[model samples]
Target: MEYLKRFLKSIGWIARGVDLLVAPLTIISGLSFRAMKFIGVKKFPINNSLFHKIGFFPIVNHYYEPQFDFKGYSQKIRHFEGIDFNAEAQLTLLHSFEYKQELDALPNVKSDGGGYFFNNGSFESGDAECYFSLIRKFKPKKIIEVGSGYSTLMAVEAIKLNRMEGEENMCTITCIEPYEMQWLSDIEVELLTQKVEDADLGLFEKLEAGDILFIDSSHIIRPEGDVLFEIFEILPRLRSGVLIHFHDIFTPLNYPEKWLKEEFRMWNEQYLLEAFLSHNAKFEVVLALSYLTIYHKQEVCDTFPVYAKDAGKTLGSFWIRRL
Candidate 1:
């Protein structure tokens, strides 16, 4: 009986290894066909150069102000210590993460309404910068990302840079998406075209501590409880020192004034982390930057103060750690 059990476990591992090897190629093949249909021809050439030049001239003054929340931004949330909110500090941090150069080179995607889209879909410039910085800092061995978009590209770039810099560990990525995007076909990430809650997380059984788990898929379609439940399912399987990033935490329900567009108002999605924190006392906030919040399993041990604009104002990102 013992031999039979061990043999069955070995078979499972072998099957997963085969999946890891072939999934990316299969996904890329399907995505290539899809891309031919959707992105083969452009309706109009998106002139990002002209638009970016205009972006230099601030047309709206209110954009510089701090965003307001339902608690009026004075809710006194706990934040990481020693964050400098000055312009110089912001520039320095962006430079440290190589985000400034990347942002400058990004192309602008034009929507049907004649508006420009940056950082793929959903993620803003701030979000991209933060994710890049985190990837560079931690060098997570396994990245389990639940969403497929520009962030996928950014993560791949970060991993490649890490390898170039002589990081001996090879980082592998697994992206879970119900609907795959064509641009991601260029990368070698394992693509799972299924709901995150339904996908087989046993693939992560080999991931040790300090791996990254990023969640940024559906915002409104699933109930908040369902989302939290899925998180609960995955959390216990992870190592304690692993980093988990959750996107769209700063939703309209909590922070109303921080919204850049009217579409955000209709998102009507709640941050599941808030509820997760309320019930479970295991994780702590590493940082909360504009729609993105990072967390980990451990006591807080950093002196970097969270950089907020002022009283009744929110910073683009802030860090919180577990107690």
Candidate 2:
């Protein structure tokens, strides 16, 4: 079955590549498809896969219309009349950077040792710095990290520092991840080798005020997916004052244009988060790395001059507090 699925996916990719090669012909084919539909044509001699391969069918073919007006939704969010949470979150992030020296003292943060390291692929662009600093600043008693990897390493280092400072309440760290990463076994965290959707919902309910729920989700919102479960099921069940971290979230702006057109990354987690926070008062933004990197460039540069020079001007970590 796996091989069959792979074969079908390969065929689909080939069709899309062929369509891109004959781009002008696909536009004409799209117009013809629309005209045929208007004349009460039920089916075409060619399969629907040919029409699906056309990139502009969602715009050109009336029958293959978009489900939502994404542009209008984005504009509405830009002009939202609610409290300026992004601005407030920027201040929170700036304050967290006061612990920069302490974060630097951690042995495993950027080390090339057997333990975890940060600022590598996927965790760079200032997100790793923000994560380590926030964990050090907040000193969350309990940290339940979903989809863990590099962030888990940061959390472990921060907790070690907290414990070293004689904070007796430095509590347990739990990581829920389906994929096998052997390094997790060496750490102090309780690793649950399963998907977040399959894990017990009670785990999230155990999180109290001042605890942390760090989520690095799949970014897709399909039915029964991890992103949907986190947004709908887990988020509502958490206690007030819980700090929630979402990685790879670029809010108050769309995902980068290059990421969309060139890389073909169709991530929609931030869009769902934007709609959820629209005039909703239960949750308040605590930190938005992308928002700060874009709008508050000077402050970020001053705070982490090395990161600014190395990673360029983009970060994807976002934080919020459950009110």
lDDT of 1 by residue, 114-222 (tens): 3224525465455555676677777878888778676777677667777887867579898887674754555788887777777776865555666777777555534
lDDT of 2 by residue, 1-323 (tens): 56876887778858877768889987887677667666644465353555565433323323364233233333212445663566865675585567656545544345546444544566653677777667767777889989888778767767777788886748798999878576787888899889899989999998888899999978888888999999999999999999999887777677765666557566888888878887878998888777777677777766654465664756788888899
The lDDT of each candidate is 0.53, 0.74
The total number of steric clashes, by the backbone 3 Å criterion, in model 2 comes to 0
Model 2 clashing residue pairs (backbone): none
TM-score of each: 0.53, 0.75
Prediction-by-prediction clash tally: 16, 0
Which regions of candidate 2 are displaced past 4 Å? Answer: 1-77, 86-89, 105-112, 167-169
Q: On a 0 to 100 scale, what is the lDDT of residue 46 in model 1? A: 47
Top lDDT hit: 2
